[model samples]
Target: MIYIPKMIFHGNPLSFGQYFYDVWGGVSYWFTSALSVAQILLAALFLSQRDRMTFYVGTCTLLSLLGIYLRNTLPSPFPWYYQTGMVSTLLMSLGGVYLRYESRINKLVSKPYVFGIAAFVYLSYVMITNPAHPQGTTPDICMYLWKYLTILCSIICIIALSHLLPQAKWLEYIGKNSLIFYFFSGTMLALFGSITSLLAPDTSYILTLTVTSIALLAATGIN
Candidate 1:
């Protein structure tokens, strides 16, 4: 149903199966990462705390470094879904495990400021040192490292901000239907753009963008 818009406007001729495969295959990395994390959780049941910590830490460091290496070595337009996906997922999963474990042990982890401060420091360093990159590539080693590290830091900061912010019913509503939003996001974005162009062709670009963003959010919430 979502592809109907693409077919009508863009003349996309892909069949349903092709569209599904293309879309679903893009998320296969998450499936792989989930499987790996499941194995780690199962192993954690038998391992001692120290062993679990060491294992998670080791995997996190190795995966981050590997991702940096791959970013540098792999050619542009690399198969990110397969290659970098595993690296990113494993790194994030392990880092999450370590964070959970630490939070359990340390009461200070309950404070959002802890992670918020760390995230700020990491982002500041990345901005100060690795400031420039070409349009489509990360040929610089510093930029490569900055890109991966900042992703982790940004995740931490977002989690911290979520903790710091007061809860809203609208956000909760969106969270409850996050999966629907995720699946429909691309289609809705395209559809919204078409609708904007048709309805308000003379609108300024900034106004069009604002309307499109609001429409996308509203569609996701309604879905």
Candidate 2:
């Protein structure tokens, strides 16, 4: 009802990183190398039998703190995206680990089943409430399908991992924070983008990106 556009074409306005890239000629695309590394590290941590949760939690917290610092001090072209991606991947990875390691034999209802059901319901709600109708450019059907697929994959991974691992408190904590971090990060990006647009209307995209990245980095360092 808030006139939210479909995330595929119009993209989500609340997603600062996405919006920043859209406006700055896609500068953030270059950082995918770093993001890919981070993703791999997180996924590996989840899969490993070693003290994986401890390492995962420490890394996630560090990155999140770094993101906050960067937001304040660095001249990032797309700080929001970087921060959100860092946090999201961490949480998702932790969720996967938790799904693998949490105990269910002692409980009547398993956590993975509950989480899977909840995620499914939420996805369904998004699909039904989506304002875009058939073939609308704003919310392409493929985008919706992709979202569902990602969620499904994540849920399946969690379920499978839970069966394999059987105990990981860090994953539970990370999963709890993931939702909160996602919402807050989106809001922060929108606010930062609006401020930058208003305050530096004539600035070149490169300069803006650089300055923002610096500011974000500095902020992360300080906090």
Candidate 3:
């Protein structure tokens, strides 16, 4: 992420400099890495101290946002939704951890067609309103609300789908082999992009996306 932005977009001169320069070139890398680590810690904490989940989630969330508020954090440019995403992802992480343990909510949401319909309707509503991307100079409260609700809806829909789509063996195969796919995919896509640029830089956006998706799937399928 940091490398692409620096090397490709901003064209940072220090991209090939000393290793320390590469890291010090931007705090975004550190912040992004730290946020990922924070999620891991929060997940472990949530799993261990289920009784105090509310406090843990609230504290983790507030601490993350408080840093931005205190420092007057700036917004990331296009293609990087870190500003609002920083908070939304954490909230979603919390939701995922809570869902793993809370059978009551899962059972409630997993009801046939309820979650499926709810997820569909909510996404439709979002598409209707051209909500401004939240990771901008001015954040909207609705964006936060939207992400919060959407993550829950996604979880519910997944549960609903498990009951509805289990007969699809390919989905099961993909799920079983997901880790290997995740590991090799980044390099495969980067390599594919380089190849594309050399052959044809002005490839259509649709074609680029389609090829990228296909390449990623192909990368995952390899032994």
- Identify the runs in model 2 with alpha carbons over 4 angstroms from their true place: 1-51, 75-80, 103-223
TM-score for each of the candidates: 0.58, 0.30, 0.55
Model 2: lDDT equals 0.52
- lDDT digits (tens) for residues 122-218 of candidate 2: 5665676577845445343345345545565555545555667766885665465554443333344444556677777776878567656654444
Candidates 1 and 2 compared: the better one by lDDT is 1
Report the lDDT tens digits of candidate 3 across residue range 1-223: 3255334544445434543444443333444444454555566666766675566667667755653553344554222223433454456656656666878766777776677677886786567555764434436545555655676677677766676664777667767876656545655666677777888878798868976887767765684
CA displacement after TM-score superposition, residue 9 of candidate 1 (Å):
5.2
Could you give candidate 1's per-residue lDDT for residues 37-118 as a string of tens digits? 4455436533654555566656656655665576457734223234354355455555557567666624454466778776
* Ranked candidates, highest lDDT first: 1, 3, 2
- Could you give the candidate ranking by TM-score, starting with the highest? 1, 3, 2
List per-prediction Cα lDDT, in the order shown.
0.60, 0.52, 0.59
**Candidate with best lDDT:** 1
**Candidate 1: deviation at residue 96, Å?**
3.1
Candidate with maximal TM-score:
1
